[model samples]
Target chain A: MTESPQGQAPSGAAADVPVAFQDPSYLAAVVDLLGAIAYGEMSAFERLAEDAKMSPTLADKAELARMASTEFGHFEGLRQRLADLGADPFEAMAPFEKPFDAFHARTAPSDWLEGLVKAYVGDGLAADFYREIAAFLDAGTRDLIIESLADAGQSQFVVDRVRGAIEDDHRVGGRLALWGRRLMGEALSQAQRVAAERDALSALLSGGVDRPGMDLAAIGRLFTRLTENHSARMEKLGLAA
Target chain B: MTESPQGQAPSGAAADVPVAFQDPSYLAAVVDLLGAIAYGEMSAFERLAEDAKMSPTLADKAELARMASTEFGHFEGLRQRLADLGADPFEAMAPFEKPFDAFHARTAPSDWLEGLVKAYVGDGLAADFYREIAAFLDAGTRDLIIESLADAGQSQFVVDRVRGAIEDDHRVGGRLALWGRRLMGEALSQAQRVAAERDALSALLSGGVDRPGMDLAAIGRLFTRLTENHSARMEKLGLAA
Candidate 1:
């Protein structure tokens, strides 16, 4: 499996040129990826806020609110970067709204614990997918993609809350485990739709001869890694993934 | 005609021991006031995000999202201050949840223009009311309240959007004017309910002998100021007050 370049390229891939973004197509592809990520952030902000309403306590509500705000921060960062690249952030973001919105609408959590699991499991899968895609990009763009994912640091709070809930009622673990699997299914269908529609993003994963591209097998392994990570996250929450 | 203290104290008041919060009741009152403001921020974030959905364009949605995030930021600041004062931030914010939630529920905007008007008119009224009440506090608390209000900055986008829409369709102006009034009415009803229910908050405004406070006439004058500001905001947005 070819690892997405990230900052760890084989000796000197990005070293030849300042970055892979010099090519207009590469630049546009990067922009498309960033735009998708930015829209994802906006969706997270709105979805998390709606979920916050289901919060059982003020403390719980505050946590979800903080998560929403953090997602907004990432969106802003991505938006600014898109602008810096001479792209209209709104137009850049427009194409991905449907798939993202559909994903959210279909996977809307039924309760607070489910919301937590959705956020944790869903975000984990998306981040892993992006991280894999990040490997085929220039260091700078990959770094930005990775950094945006990093801000969601330590899901320990979500882990504790989800685990604690299941501990209180073992039956919850069974329900939530099913919920996690459904979230993963919805996410994969959405991602597949997005991949079919977004040619540039697909190109990012399967790069050209001049770029660090993933072969068909590597792409399969990327999906494998994403699924594995998702299961690990659910297991962390004591859910059978 | 009175300037909200902000950081200024009269010749003798807030002088004896530096501030009135030395008294336990005053301390509780200040904490209560901060809690209300913090929870107000939380409500604003949720309400603004909901309103953002009614945005006619992605740009407009981004503007409202920025406002929502700013409100969340203010909430975080106030929550931190509550913690610094040895108050449980969530508990301190608990008392305010009902009133703020009621205000939001009763004033949820039906569309983009109405949302803008609500954000403009409703927030303007609330800010004015709080600014007036801030006059009865110590400089530090007063400054914090004032700063939290300040981050809202000028709602120039709302003003421009509403005014532009009204210019395009004059009927919108009349409808929004009514909305402005309805918002003011709902806000005042909620305010009165909160004031009647929260004795500490009421006491904060009508200070005890040791602290600077407003007389009945002064309180009436404060309402006058609030009404005037609300009218001014509506007018700025090209709506009738």
Candidate 2:
């Protein structure tokens, strides 16, 4: 991957760019990907903090605050990494602002339960998609992406609360199942829009000269995996995908 | 400070309590103080995140998010400390929730500039009050309070932005000056209510047998100091106190 067709190391990439990301297109894609993740984390932080205000108990509020803080911490790391790569973090994140904002606006949870479902289901789907893309990146960038997506292990409480609520009344499950499907739809639509708009990010999946890229079949399989995981998550939460 | 009038260490203090905080009253006051600070930090986090949405520039939004994250980090620390002291952090925090909520509701900023002023002035005032109370606590608790109150140094951007707006329009200065005063008024009223209701917390100001407590004159001086600091912060923001 380090040597191109000329049998020499590629040199046009930024001095700080890793050998694996020496391709300008590859570097651009990584930046775009990081930018999206950073902004996603920031948006998640905002939404989670907002949901915290609706918590039924102080303990639940603190838990949500902890989750928000964790996401913000991930954002700080990505911001610093962008600066280290000589990309303006905010500029990197700018292109992603609209789609993310739209997604949040469209899926604004009506209450605390819906918020938990969104956090769990939405984050689960995004994490799955990012993990799929991480397969094509340099180890360093991939590690950062995976670390940023690490579950804070607060999901159990989300699952517990959500499942407990559904058990109290079968009708609650029916309503949340619809909410889960809505979140999945909105998420997929936003993901599609992001893919259509970010050429470099999309190109990351199509192999360049030195990298192994996924074919259309693999891309289909990736989506299948993402959908399957989302379903599994919804099932765990006593909701339907 | 470690010994009582009987020339012995106080008993019935929690086993984990520090020697200087073994006076149950002092311990309760310290717990109350920590709880108030924790809840205050949590509310600040929410307000700052809310303000980030109103930020005119993406850069400004990121800055406010950074400040909000820092406040949440402080809240986490105070929460853990409360638990370590054998206090249910949430229960300890319960008493102060109403006043803090009322303060935020009453002083909700009308615009981005107003939010900036409130963050600067309100946080500055709260930090000052906590620092004053810190004086009556044990070394351990005092250090914890001081650490939690440590500024994240994001205030310079707030100062620059507010002052720049005032420079561009003198009318902004007049309006913000009034906003700053309103914030101070709302904060003071809420704080007085907290003081009036939380007996142990209020007693923290009245030095005990083992510790140097503030007399009424000293108490008056503390408020004077707080008001002076608030005015100074307002002046720094190019506003009237």
Candidate 3:
């Protein structure tokens, strides 16, 4: 059977919600956006846990576990928000699952350092994109999105580990650069897939009845900023962007 | 090289702590006990995250992830305590790796239900044993241990899942009963191994110069209580003890 279109509201206690969300499409779009972030957090948690498996030291493992726990923490916040918005959080998260799962499966890190780079670069990009989207959202949701995007100082941890590994062996730098680029590419591809499939999300991005949003040119600038930040992150790790 | 005995205080800031913890041996033992629980929490995090993979639905997966996050939360608290006591948390947890990993391996669940049962039953048993050991500890350490063992209401989730499964198919209850028994047995074996290997921990339990501890009868009763609790838990899942 063909999959249901994204942002089609799942039946639940959505009727009594606020005026802002009363428009069914706005509610669906918000649910879709929140769902995507929720799935992203869960996937991040799973990937981070998997990454810990390859940690060379117990300290490193603990670091990865800490990141995993923090991602799960954000996940709870998003899931609750989805419920408060009157969507069943799980059903809300369902549409984006295939894309996120596929991204992780394709980019499964072969070793510890690569896993660290992916954790940092990939999540950094996702956070950037979400922050941009938050600009077009309501104050409450935008704040929640921004709050959930807090990296908890994890980027520095990844930078230190990755840079330390590169210093230990200069040759490691070249391989990880490729790994970082691939992470960006795969992440973008999956994200594009999500954008194409999720009409409500696209509508939210383009502009809604009352909410202001990014124009095509504005979005292009946003992409430029995202790419620039990704490069800057790679540079921080002593790698070529 | 022979593995260092569990609870051997590594040399460091342990030099000038509290008067009680200043007894290097007592310090090592407490660090060791905290380390054991810390490693147990990490292992539990890993195991719960693994169990989440088999979740039949996104909601179930989130429930497992929430539990995993809570375990890591406890782990962070214990690790901080270890550092406060002047031990590198990793080195402290190192001695426990083999036993906890082995216990998890032996009791690895064959399916989702088995994993849930292991999570609820195995962790319940470990918490009971730790609480028993906590009775012999200093107030600070004892309080930390008790705090770390908080179940976060996970029992009801597991019980609901397991009981619902049993109701769906009676045969499931019989198999889960055996799984629960295996989890209990493996847990006891690992706990015995830890006791035999950690001299300071054993000394702590048996009573040191100033510390009052479990007499042989008290130890026997502790075992009786742990077993009774396990039986009660199994009964709650609609399985035989």
Candidate 4:
């Protein structure tokens, strides 16, 4: 990952570049998007650590706790990366705090497996979105995003565990599949709410005259990839579409 | 701390070896004692992570989560150490799990300050006890015990925050002081119960053969030291003894 050169636009910069960074609207929109995602990561870490207690045995408990700790590492990475971009991590994240928080509060997991499902579904989408955005950033910012992406290790563990549980208990598949769908719905709904309010960010996704090839179709492609991965994960867990 | 020499008389060894380890009658008692402590640490970690949400900001939340993570690290260390001693950490910690769980389950902190007070008081006692016991063990076990002591970085932060709160509202001090007292009472009561049930452990504490140098006096000294430190902390926070 390389940081974008300051002042100098890329040879094939997106047409929307003038609107994405130079325009106040675009900067605010980008900040809003980054802020919401950063806050979500922070809250997710908290939830994972708390949910770890639901493990049935000491070994499971230890593993879950370790997994949860990785969230903080991810949170820190995101925060520092945001700081590198000249944004206060808190300020960038503050606006979406309430909505993201309410989402989790309303859907708190009832058990260990449910928590794992939340991690798998929620973090999977977050990582996908982040990876897409990282594609447009400068070297330093791209590197940070890539580093932050590594924080999803524990989420992968959760996916494996949830899949194993479903395999072992075929009856659980229906309920968990429904749970996964709900998680995605809530996540996408919240994301749409964020995108609706941040036009500059939407512009960044749509790429501009500077970069003729960028557009909402790219965003659509990103979402398609995320849903595909999510569907495969559900099937691997013995859950239906 | 060095390992006790093989074939040495148990009486000649340091008073730290719970007689239950050598005496069948004392095994259950020792296991129950260690298990309760282990479980207590586990529960505390979970509660602390949950409480981290009350932090006024994301950075604060991260700090609290990091602190909570340390508890899990300690839990793992203790678990591994127990396993090395041929005891299952979960099994050894299981007999009193209900009571210990009930204590924490009932006393869950409602706010950041309350949580900090719990950490400040609870961790103080644990560190005190571990420090004293370390003196009685062989070099390796003692070093392991010392190394497993939970770091006070998070607790100190909590203490600072709690103290800052008390400075703004004197009444806050009274409530926290009372909470601290109750926490200590429950902890001491549980300790006594475990002690009474395990005579070899009791004997190990009481010293090899007689009462003066036994575990009780050591416990008493530990309590004194803990209370002294607690008093200083309370004074710093403007809380009444």
**A130-186 per-residue lDDT for model 4 (tens digits):** 777767654455565566667453355665787788778887778888898988888
Local lDDT at B113 for model 4: 83
Clashing residue pairs for model 1: A4-A135, A5-A135
Q: Could you give the CAPRI-style class of model 2?
A: medium
Chain B TM-scores, listed for every candidate in order, come to: 0.90, 0.91, 0.91, 0.77
- Over the stretch B1-241, how does candidate 3's per-residue lDDT look in tens digits? 5656575554543323465676787888888889999999998999899889999998888888889889999999999889888789999999999999999889889999999988888888888988988887767788888999999435688889899999999999999998889889998999899999999889889887777877999889989999999999899989998
Which tens-of-lDDT digit does each residue in B1-241 have in candidate 1? 4785676655432343344456888888878988999998888888888888877888888888888889889888888878867789988888888888888888878888888888777777777777888877777777778878874625888888888998899999999999989988988898898889899889988888777778899989888888888888888998878
Instruction: Report the poorest 10 consecutive residues by lDDT, candidate 1 chain A.
Output: A10-19
Under CAPRI classification, how is model 4 graded?
A: acceptable
Over A139-241, each residue of candidate 3 has an lDDT whose tens digit, in order, gives 6788888989898424688888888888999999999999999999999899899999999999999987677877889889998999999999889889999
Candidates 1 onward: DockQ, in order: 0.54, 0.56, 0.66, 0.45
RMSD of candidate 1 to the true fold? 7.5
Give residue B181's error in model 4 in angstroms: 2.0
**Full-model lDDT, candidate 3:** 0.87
Q: Candidate 2 — what's its lDDT?
A: 0.86
Tens digit of per-residue lDDT, candidate 2, span B39-59: 999889889988888999877
Q: Best candidate per lDDT, number?
A: 3
Q: Show the colliding residue pairs in model 2.
A: B207-B213
TM-score of each: 0.91, 0.91, 0.91, 0.80
- Candidate 4 lDDT, tens digit per residue, B1-241? 4655675545422334544256443444344445655676777677778888787877778777777767776777677667755688878877666666766776688788887777777777766766765564455456655666655433567767887888889888889989878877777776677667656556645555322344456677777887787677666555776
Error of 2 at A48 (Å): 1.0
